[model samples]
Target: MNEHILLVNPWIYDFTAYDLWMKPLGLLYLASHLKNSGYKVTLLDCMDRHYPFMPLPDHPGPKRLKSVGCGSYYREKIPKPAQFLSIPRYWSRFGIPWDEVKKQLKEIEPPGWVFITGTMTYWYPGQVAFLNLVRQLWGKTQVIIGGWYPTLCSEHAHQWGFDRIIEGIDPLLVIKQLSSDFKELSTITGYKEFFSVKPAFDLYKKLDYTVVLTSIGCPFRCTYCASGRYFSEFWRRPWEQVLDEITYDYENYRIQDLAFYDDALLYRAEESFLPLLKALQKERLPLRFHLPNSIHARYVTREIAELMRECNFETLRISLEFSDVDSQKNTGNKVDNFIFEKAIQSFIQAGYAPEELEVYLLFGLPGLKAKDYELSIEYVTDLGLKPRLSLFSPLPGTPDFEKVIMHQIKDDPLFQNKIAYLYLSEQNELYEALQRKISKYTFFH
Candidate 1:
């Protein structure tokens, strides 16, 4: 019999969280990799909003899901962790109840190894809770944790005491390392083998949508982004592989709403992304594409805009991190005024409702006054685009984060939490006020 491997997506313990086209794609990819290697794989997503028996005994059921497949998670109020006690918000575990999780785990066979995924470096407490539960039931099961938390903050990760920690963003690299350590695991290497297999989306009985990454890394090294740190150089999948995955998603999973998790999908739009869009257009699979991750404004050409509309792009969000024209010109970090405005106009001309498009504006940066956000909100609203306040929280692996963040965040991932950052910096009030201001400004426009 094949050895069993359990893939667990831990709950998110935070002030607030919403499932905005989010899924544990990295872990699911590993599930496919291991299953291909002749291991039986199982997934236990604590954050699954569509968990079959959703409206269990006392629950009001999960929050309503939007037509676009993005909405609230099933959350329950929980005590704020000691580190977060200083912050005055009610914390919650944004997922299924722990009691329900325990009841479900009882039915599963004890696996040889357990794989858990980490996100938002600070959200490790949920992982700990799951691990503790597993320890009682499946004693000695080797638990390997991966994703940004371990890769970015290894020191902080080690404190969690998981059996193994696989660092880095590349799933193939993680599999390669595991194969070297334990020959029983998959022996794949590089992107070639990685893309050959589809992610184990079938592991779920149902899915709201599926996420696809046509490329890895990003070309632009924006000061606030960690893309450069992770990939160093940009790389996109072969045209054949991406096309295959998209078609497979539609055929196998009926995935109408496909979200692109690419950091920079439009970097080389014509060659890298356009061909895929054109192929999807030709196929006309009745798929609606989304970009939860913002795309580059500089690369949003009129033709690309038109093609995106033709391809049924729903969330056409672009990065307009700030409205400081002088800063943009001097830094060349973000797109210039001419390019940004042109992109918006192209989208409008492409038949996208001006209200449907979202323009992300970075807020909460150290030394960035609320007045800066006021100007950005005004600028974005004036253009008839919804202003999304992008939080300027520290990401450990990013160069900018290392330079300015305090030793506290460096020592403990808890301090890296977004809400924690706002309060610690004494700017929580400003962020809240800006949010209200953005909503008020964008309402009429």
Candidate 2:
């Protein structure tokens, strides 16, 4: 008998949540692998916007959806977690209702095992709530929790009532563990290559848009980033394979909006990105691509910019963490003003207007002056590019993680909340003023 496995993308319990092309790519990847390995797999995405329960009383009237299948999730305002009571914000569980979750769980077959994956350590409250519900309905089943939350907060996550917790991104180890549950399981070979099974996007009730990852890992180890930690070695899929996935989505589901979830999407232009882009342009599929994760500013040459334009990239955000020379050097020398300017000009020449070009600016880094952040915003805006301010949240295992020293941050993951930190009201006058100053920018305001 095939072992029935249940995969879950748990609820996001936060003060605010939005669908920024966010999907459970990891869970889907796991689902595909399990199906290929001759196991039955099911996904319970609590955050599913297309959840069959229609006209939820909490959300009345027309659904508010936005560009490229990105929009709001069904939400219900819940009481703030005790730790977050100090911050004056309405907390909500972003996803289907509890009643609906119970109904869905009752409908599924008794699974041989359950796997839960989540991101963002601060959102563990949702995981706790989810596990409580699972325990109530399913009894004491074998539950495995993984993803960034468990990987970063293994010690903190132990109290959360999981049977096992996989610490890293190794699916092979997970499979080996699963073999113990089923006596008939045979030794699996070429498991790494077996991950090529098309992600189980078919599992969803409806398809709006899809996400693709042409590459994994990153070349640079920035001080405040955990991408390198998650993926030890940098690797890229063949362009043909990537193109096949995109074409599958386009042909079967009529999905036009595609997002790239790569850390170093444009690291080696000729080998990985360029060939893929050229193939996409040649195919001339009427599809729109988005890079929610910003691309390296220094890598954007004139030719690359043109290729992006031709390939129907609807949204482009350049990673320009800071314009200051010292700050640039401090953050792995990711981007310099000269290179940024060249990229901007090339983008302009390739037909991107000022409004279309968005530049990301990092705010609230330790030892960074408020004036430097202000100047960086001003510099980007002066160059006719939109400045997008991203607050810095220290991730565990990153180079800068050891340097954080504000109000028991190291002890609790909740302190990792970047936006909520502004509401703490304990910051210095200069830091508060800088927050107020950035608020004036129309993009944020």
The best candidate in terms of TM-score: 1
TM-score of each: 0.93, 0.92
- The lDDT per prediction is 0.80, 0.79
Off by over 4 Å in 2: 54-65, 170-194, 425-445
TM-score of 1: 0.93
lDDT of 2 by residue, 1-445 (tens): 5878888888888877877788888788778767877888889988888889733434333342365777777788888767678776788888888788888899889786788888788787777777777788778577888877787888998988788877876445455555566433335433346346788999988878999988767888889998866765677788898899999989988986989998889888789789988899899999999999999877888888999999989888898988899888987987899998998999999999877877888766777776787798789878866777777777888877677666567777877776565455244455556656555665552
Reference-based lDDT, residue 232, model 2: 51
Candidate 1 C-alpha lDDT tens digits along 143-228: 88887888888887787678988888765668766785457555465676777778889988888799998887877767666655
User: Which sections of candidate 1 miss by over 4 Å?
Assistant: 56-65, 182-186, 329-332, 403-407
Q: Which candidate leads the pack in lDDT? A: 1
